[model samples]
Structures are given as C-alpha cells and as structure tokens.
Target: MKPRPLDGITVISLEHAVAAPFASRQLADLGARVIKVERPGVGDFARAYDTRVKGEASHFVWTNRSKESLTLDLKNPDALAVLMDLLKNADVLLQNLAPGAAARMGLSFEALHEKHPRLIVCDISGYGDNGPYRD
Candidate 1:
C-alpha cells in the first residue's frame, strides 16, 4: 500500500464540542496521529451529549475516531509541562477552547511560535482574537 500524505504528521488538539474534533478526525483519517486533550475527570463535555451509540455518545464516537485521548488540567503545572513537551515535537496544534482559554494557557500562536517555530497553531473560536466579542 502507498503511504498516506499525513502519515508522519502529529496533531495535538485541545478541543471541545464538534468543529475542532471534526477537523482532527479528518487529519486522523488521512493517517496523521491526533492527540485529543480534554479536561481531567470530566473529559470532553461532548462525551455526555447522549448515549445513542452502544452507551457512547454518537457525536463523540463519530468525531473522535482514530485518535488518542489525553486528559489534562491545564491549570496544573505538571499537566502544562506535559503539554509543552508534546508541543515541542508536534506538527500542528488545533484548539477550539472557550474564548480566551487557549490564550490564558499560553497556547496562543504568538506565545508558542517562538519556542516551536515550525508548529502550526490553529485556533477556532466563534469570535476572532482581539475583537469586541472576544472574551
């Protein structure tokens, strides 16, 4: 078989809800490694949407396939350290965290670009950064 285009790529996503997970699923389908970062103890809120898939949420099952899930509390120093280490070698960082959440965790493109120059950071939010609605 031929190698997939994204066979050697790695993506780390701090996501919730549908959009970001959907995007990461596409990358995973293309053969990239996707690591989903969720809140410890709670995991992704989407996981609780409904148990329509053999006791699993249908939406969660659809958008989370072919990826790995990692629970982390970004507020914790050790967890933050783990994330920073992961970012060191990650090809891409995709996050759809609540408004200003990523920035609060120092995961913004501007903050991470210097340390991980080649890292591609994609922030998906309803409001763009620095806009009047940006919270």
Candidate 2:
C-alpha cells in the first residue's frame, strides 16, 4: 500500500452544495486537514436536504469529515476578511461557488497566488472556467 500524497497539507474550502467539498474531503482522506466553510445561520443547505441516514444528511456527511466546519458569509466584508485570514494559514484552497463568484471574490488561483505563493488552489464548477456554460 502507498501513502496519500497530501499527508501534511491543509485544505480550506469555501463551498456549498457538493463538488468542492467532495474534492477537499478526498484530500482529507489522504491526511490533509480540510476545513469546510459555509454560511453561519443555516450552515450548508445540504444539511437540511434529508435525514435519511440516521438523521444525517447523506450529502453533507459524505463530503465532510476529518475537517473543521467554518461558517462565513462571503458576501460580507468582515466575513470575507476573516476568510482572507484563514487563507493565510492554508496550504490549499478549494471552492465550488457559482460562475464568476471566484473571480468576483478575487479568490481565483492567480489572485491567491499573489500572496500565498506556495498555496495550491482548485476551483470546481459544473462548467469549465471561461466556458459556454458559464454565467
């Protein structure tokens, strides 16, 4: 058997829905410390989807584990600032926000790279960046 490559990395994800969280958790499975960020009041909406498995939302539990749960409203300036602080300590950043959201938030790989030169960023979306499906 071989060890997972991201053993010592820490992944911080600004996510909702599924895709990005799914990816970060895989990184966590390999020993990375993944943090899943969501809105404060409601948390991730997926948590309310259905309590099918022992009162747990299948989607939320599946993509989230061995990670910290951070609640931040990206739309708010203070919250965004807090997220920036979090980025300062992260080795990797993951997100699955809507089309243009990453760029709007300036959380794109290039933007983040300017500060954390060694940080790895991954943006997951239904469509590719600059694609026909983009909004």
Candidate 3:
C-alpha cells in the first residue's frame, strides 16, 4: 500500500455550484477529507438542477462523491459557531460563494488568518475581491 500526499489533510468547503465543488472533489481524490457545507433544509442549489441520475442531480453526484456533506445556515449564530469550530482544525477552507458573499460572512482570508494562521483559505469568485465591478 502507498500513502497519499493529502492523506491527513482536512478540507472544509462552503460551496454551492460547480467550480468550488469540482476543486474540492480533486482534493478528496488526492486523499484529503473534504467536508462540504450546505444550507440547512435547502442543501446545494445544484442538487436540484435536474433529476437525471436516478432522482439525484447528475452534477451533484459527479462532484460530491467521496466527501462528507453538512447542512448549516451560516446566518444562524449556532450554525456559524459550529462552522467556526470545524475551521479550528481544518487545513483548508474552500469557497466559491457569490461575489462578496464570503467576505460578508466574515470568512475573508484576512479575518480567518488571524485566528487560524495555518489555514489555507481559497475564495473563488468571478470578479476579484475589490474593484468597481466587484458586485
């Protein structure tokens, strides 16, 4: 047996669509533990894109395998606390939320870097963090 490079890494992803999930899926494939955070009761929007895979969304099935899924409403204090606890030990935090979404939730790299110095925060957005068109 061989040891994978990411065998002990823990990835916590605040993702909804394809891009972030795709990236995290690759990490999981490399042996990282990927935990996907979704909205409670709603889950990921992509989950309802279509019922092409035996009642499961094809896109969801494709990128969500080999990972754990957790439902939490970031707006809820309790839920946010739970997520914060998870981040305490996570090696990476990957999010492809809407522009400014993560920042609005206080998940910006700068904010988290202070607490989790070693945490890698990857924010994927169509537009860069700041600029006239960052909306």
lDDT tens digits by residue: candidate 2, 1-135: 677788768888888777787788788988888888888899888887899878879888887877889788889999999988988988988888887787798898878888999888888886777778865
Query: Which 10 residues in a row give candidate 2 its minimum summed lDDT?
Result: 126-135
Off by over 4 Å in 2: 1-4, 130-135
Better by lDDT, candidate 3 or 1: 1
Candidate 3's residue-wise lDDT over 1-135, tens digit each?
A: 588889999999999888899999999999999999999888999999899998879999999989999999999989989999999999999998888788888898998999999999998865666787666
The TM-scores, one per candidate, come to: 0.92, 0.86, 0.91
Off by over 4 Å in 1: 126-135
Q: How accurate is candidate 1 locally (lDDT)?
A: 0.93
For all candidates in order, the CA lDDT equals: 0.93, 0.84, 0.92
Best by TM-score: 1
* Pick by lDDT: 2 or 3, better one: 3
In terms of lDDT, model 3 sits at 0.92
Rank by TM-score, highest first.
1, 3, 2
- Could you tell me how far off, in angstroms, the CA of residue 34 lies in candidate 1 after the best superposition? 0.1
RMSD of 3: 1.9
